[model samples]
Target: MELLVKSIALKSPLYTSVHLIIILASAILGFLAYKRNPNNPNNRSFLMLNLSLAVFVAVTYLSNLDLLSISTQIFINRLTFSIGFILVIVFFNFCLIFPEKETKKSFVYQLLIIACLGLAAFAAFFDWMAVEKVVSGLVTFRPRYPGIFRLFFYVYALFAFWGIGILYQKIRKLKGKERTRVQYVFLATLLYIIYIFSTNLIPAYFGRRFFIGHTALGAIVFVGLISYAVIKHRLMDIKLVLLRSLAYLTMLGSLAGAFIFFVYYLKVYYQQFVDPDIVFVLASFIAAFGFQPLRRLAEKTTDNLFFRSNYDFNEALSKLSAVLNHGVVVSKLTDDLLGELKAILKAQNGLFILSKDENKFLYCLAKNSKSVTIEELEREEDIIKLREAGLEVVVNIPDDDKCYGVLALGPKQSGESYSTRDLRLLEIIAPQITMAIKTAKSQEELIEKVIEERQRINQDAHDRIYNRLGAMAKLSEAAAAQSKDKELFEQLDSGLRQTVVDLQKIVNKDTATIKTNGKLASSLKKICQQHQKDYNQAVKYSFKASNMLNLDDMAWDIECILQECLNNAGKHSGAKKIRVNLAQNNGNLVLEVADNGKGIHNLDISNLPQEHLGINGIIDRVAKFQGIVDINSNNDGTKILVSIPLG
Candidate 1:
């Protein structure tokens, strides 16, 4: 009789304990899902299902506790089963909408729910299914006509298997860690189904409960597995939820424990010891004073254990701001920014685009596998389409008229879409990036402008010096020719002739000219011979002329252009030889200057400064004459080809 009593006490705790654990775990999971995404109707429904399950389990456990009479037990059991049946039906629907799988078997799912409701109703109203009784001073339930309840169990088993199979198929198609989570859920559910079948069928077959503890153990294992998946895989940010819950729990636990201890000690001091309540009051005062500090300590410990890596959102934003201020290279800065964003938001992909032109955008940086090109996305139409489709394409263009660029970030990780907060973050960072690009462009333009101004000044100086020297020579000739006395005539003639010769030398500086009424070829030959001697380097000058071209502003410009070319070759190129050729090609004046010297390689004309005298002046003069200047150079030699359109 004692052994029987002990066995009953042990058996009574089993159902109550198992059900309580399930209720607690389910409540925790449901609360977390709801907290993370309050807008999701599926999450709300799942929370409802979990709450209903908890209530059903609690009532069943109370009935098992024998806190109520036999009739009450029967009523409670019926209610519990009804609630469980409803919860199971809701869970089936929740799975359907939550995972968002294809509903090929919708009719079958609805029919199963209907059948479960019918069975639950039958069991609740009639004794044909399950009967309640008092045996050995304990309330126990036994199936009167096992066939009806067995059918319900069989249907439950089938649905459970179907759910597991569906999840398995889905898992197979999924990639990465998400797949592993789904697979774990599948295994846990499979275990749960097996345990359910064994608890019902095995007990009924053997005429006694066999391995009843296994069902409780299985429930604990399944919930534990699910909790592991939620926290480890971050299925829904369950760690944060759990940490928050634990925070509240710690505070409540500490306060409740303190209050109870205070009241009990007060009672013991006053009633049992027959002492004044003063000592008890003093003790209570001390305990109450310690509550806040204790609460703080508990909070600190819990935070360290669970919320260790959790960073304040505002603090992270400040850190990001600091990073941006450092003026890092755009690519490296972008990579770091994206990495931080991915970690903070738990996103999958991030891309950044900067405006390249008024109508074009260049993808300056990308963090994830998002492919876009500057050439392809040149229109506003594509941008609008992307935004409409819910991509976070943050246009960095300011409200002011000067705005030009757009920044695009997109396709967050985990297939979960971006939120309003995400849009705001992108908006904030977009301006910073735009400002950086603008600063860089402005600096570049300033440098270019400085270059242009310097080049103009150098060319003006060269022109003024040449004009002044020519005027001085004309004045000296006029003064020398005006003298008339005999001694004065001889001296004046000699001096005048010398002055004229000096003036002629200035005009024919490059070569000696032959005086003739009309001899163009002879003049050309003389000019070519003069070029060979004037240039210290070995120069082969070849001249080919179609007609005697009339000298005009065009002729002076062409001569100046050739002089600039020769000056550059002599000063810059360490050449041993040169080739000067003048000809008429395609009704155009063509002058070719070639040198055997180290050539200009990879010359970036765009970045050339205004103070660059040699090349800049040559280019400016050629441009003024509407002429073409082609410069080709290699390690072997430099070649300057000048072509001016002539009639």
Candidate 2:
């Protein structure tokens, strides 16, 4: 115990430095692994492996320091051995599952791993593995002479070899990015194996420590290689990790070194002149004042050194904000925003998706990559490969309540992850994009409404009013020939012919403005009868005119809705019997149409596809009156109910 304290007081500089490096490297790697993907088994295994390595190195360092009592040292030694065994097990597990998971494993293989772990646990506590002793005011642990120690070494080696076999097998099966990941693991494992053999196996067998106890520091090299692999190969956006680490460590190291220099100078040159307490206070004040500034400077330097593309992120956002402040043309918005985001983010590919309907994307534009259609991307499971390829997924583009679109920016050109700043800027600008899209959609719908109104008037004039007028003219001419008083008949015929002309003129004028007060009920009845005659279907319809007021206001909407429903029933529903009911109730005009045919399934009326023109027209016409629609459908039949308030 006394010797242990002496060794700590006279701690080796090399030993202390090596211990710090090992500890820092292990912590950083483990943190990164867990942070990247906490739930992923592969990442978890990697974290565990790193933590075990840390424990192994830490205990070894503590035992060497000899600051603790003999019992404490022995306990630490046991922990070290136990962690070492656990490390190999974790590594083997990582090899089997990382990069890409292996789904199948034999029961025997699992039992073998368990058996190896049990043996390791036994070896960790058994004094036969290594026994502690003190000599020359220093504590040292001696392993069992070669022949016996070889058994434990061989077991660990066998497990390592199993991991190597798994890695080799995986390398053969994997391709592209996954293969690269496995290759990294293989290289890291190779270095670790070499380090263990040279530093540990050789020394224990030969009964001599190499490199004057500096050999243990070789573990840092192994940790570093693995860390490099994780940073460079597997995870794409480690720029944050690298930059933050560099900034903080550089700032800390500089401050610490400067303080040490100042203390040394003060002690050696001005011990008599300077008051030590005052100097300490001054140093504290300087450090406190300098901390933030130093950190900022270091952070800037790190960004400039490692992330040059980020320098213009703010500038890019400002430019985008300016562009999006104008008219909302969806196509223009998608095209422009996607291009800007691609440039700003330095991404290889991008997708701008806007809601075409309630359930699907209406439009998709791809920049700097092949265009993947919405149908192609609807399956979530299939896009995993694409995600790995740098798909920066952004969904519900505007806000949570309203998802106007989705934006997927591909991997950055420099293979960096999307920074928080970049995402924040995007979130900030999402509303502007959404407003623009809505405006564009509104403009489109208005134009379509105008065109449709004109077509309906022209078609209705030719099909209904014009034909009726022509038939009435012929009937009046025949009646004039049959009249006994030729003069009265001539006048009557002239008036009747003039009435037909007036009606034709009225039909050509704005159809909605044409009064439909007395005509709405009769018009609905005629439509139902005509549908029955046209399609040879049993169409039972009834219209109750009581309390139905101000019919002219809703006349156009009702006419269109009824026509569309009848047409759909005839053409699509394939029904033998159709029922139409029209009544005024609760200050609202109510219309219900039911059909005994195949029901509408998987239908979204808000975003109906192009082929359902009848249904689309019905919805559009009803919407003009701020009507409510309810559709009940099943395998047996379909029923539609529409209600438009009288107000």
Candidate 3:
């Protein structure tokens, strides 16, 4: 009863008010991020970090208040101490899995968390510092604790440094703007941790605990950087980050109004302060001249943060222009355009559907669908499928030259409605997009025609020359059988036959020569049979690939390699039997050919023996696809291995 009377007589300190504001602000920022995406582990851990900070500040401040009784004050102190360590541990956990990277907790990390939890629990139950009926009130000097409490300084330092190292590793792994934005977050977190350590732990060790109210202010840097990252770079989510700042502002406005209501309107503490009439005149003057511009500036600042830095129209235009200027492939250009636009607008998805089926294709960044046809993309919300696919704004890719298909963009990532500005930006870039599609298609068609024409001319020459060569070879063979000098005629026939084989290989240079619907197995088997008949030796062809190679040039290149290998082995290896195997291994198409004969004693793939000229051709062909060639040969036998990447 005496204690309650004494507490009532003691005036309420202003530090408690400042502490409450800080704690509230920190909590609001945390919950905002968590609520935006609770499923995201980054968001989940960030919430814990913020809540721990709030609790740390709250208890630390409340423990220093004179109104609390000795027992209550001591309990708050223990909790504050526990929360202090918990904050650092939580921060360390955050560092492990931030910016959307999944981390498997190592045994050492798990042990650290367990150790921190144990220490926190011990601190809560049993005082690390020697204390008896005392509270570290702001003005009242706290009693000197024992040396054991000082050891925790090392613990805090260890966790802080550990977090820095983990954060550094994670940041190093990132590239481009992502690394820069995360560095902001890293710097922010580092400052917060270091600030708390400098202000709280060091001061407490010296038995002069100051800056209890400032603990809340320390995390403001972190909160600001987090908001900056989100707003400027759209870090976690734009809506989540900006709303917190806006909410803080709204909260401050309400607090100011309430404070004015009590102190001025209700006159509770108004009597002792400056005169009301003079204050009212000054308040009116400030509101008239200052409030409108201040409000406008705040509004303008947020708009600039979202649009000017993040979703820049000029930058998007420049990017689209660069893509249009440099791109020769329609497929690649479409992909780059969609990706750039989606990122710039902070959009959920984007799509480009080319019309007429004349080098026409459909591309999208949407998850619901990977495909969309010209029929399905009619300006595009009119199409039920497109609306269902989450396309919110669809722009017609039409101009005087051609009526290209629609370019549709989904809703903003923040779930905000698209403005006229967004639609206009897309509108302006639509022509460049259309031209890019048209120009790429024209170039592709021209190149295809050129390839077709070249193949036609080559076929004409090959047919006439090959027939003449065949006739000459048959005549030579007849002369070899009839004439007295048979060896010379037989040698001429063999050379003619080799020339025919080389000519046939020249025709097989392009995939257009083989109309096997991109099937390697059937074509390879057929070619192997023909080669077996020519060489008059047992030849085996095995095809065992699961994933299809999508690269257009891969099939022809592989065939060329196989032909070169077979020809080299047949002519040079003097092999009786040849075994060819093709299979998929580790995302690569593995092709191996083995000849059971006297080996060529080849040492290097690039620098083969003088006689292995065809092997050099095989290596050159394989180099186009960025594939690997390994020739393992000795006195027993020779084996040629080719591994090409499969899409």
Clashes of each: 2, 2, 0
Error of 2 at 428 (Å): 3.8
The total number of steric clashes, by the backbone 3 Å criterion, in model 1 comes to: 2
lDDT of 2 by residue, 1-647 (tens): 68665765588766687778888877777766566546556657777877877777776666555456666666665556566677778877777777664346789879978987886777667665344457653455556555645766677687787888888898999897678767777877777767776776667666753221343466776776765654455342233555567689999998888777877788779889999887777777887788888887787675555454455756877888767766456677678878887777787887766644532422232221222321124333434555654565353465445555766677778755554345556766777776767777898889888897675664454434443344345445655677675654564455456446545654566556758767787778876875564456899988875754457866766766776677667667779999999988887889999999888899777778977655665666677788888888888888999998777
Tens digits of per-residue lDDT for model 1, 5-109: 453366547555677789898888887777655655545765775676566556555445443456655666666556656656665665555444234546766
The Cα error of candidate 3 at residue 136, in Å, is: 13
lDDT of each: 0.58, 0.66, 0.66
Report the CA-based lDDT of candidate 3 relative to the real structure. 0.66
Question: Between which residue pairs do clashes occur in model 2?
Answer: 237-417, 356-362
Off by over 4 Å in 3: 1-21, 128-145, 206-213, 239-301, 304-306, 309-647
Least accurate 10 contiguous residues by lDDT in model 1: 367-376
- Greater-lDDT candidate between 1 and 2: 2
lDDT computed for candidate 1: 0.58
Estimate the TM-score for candidate 1.
0.49
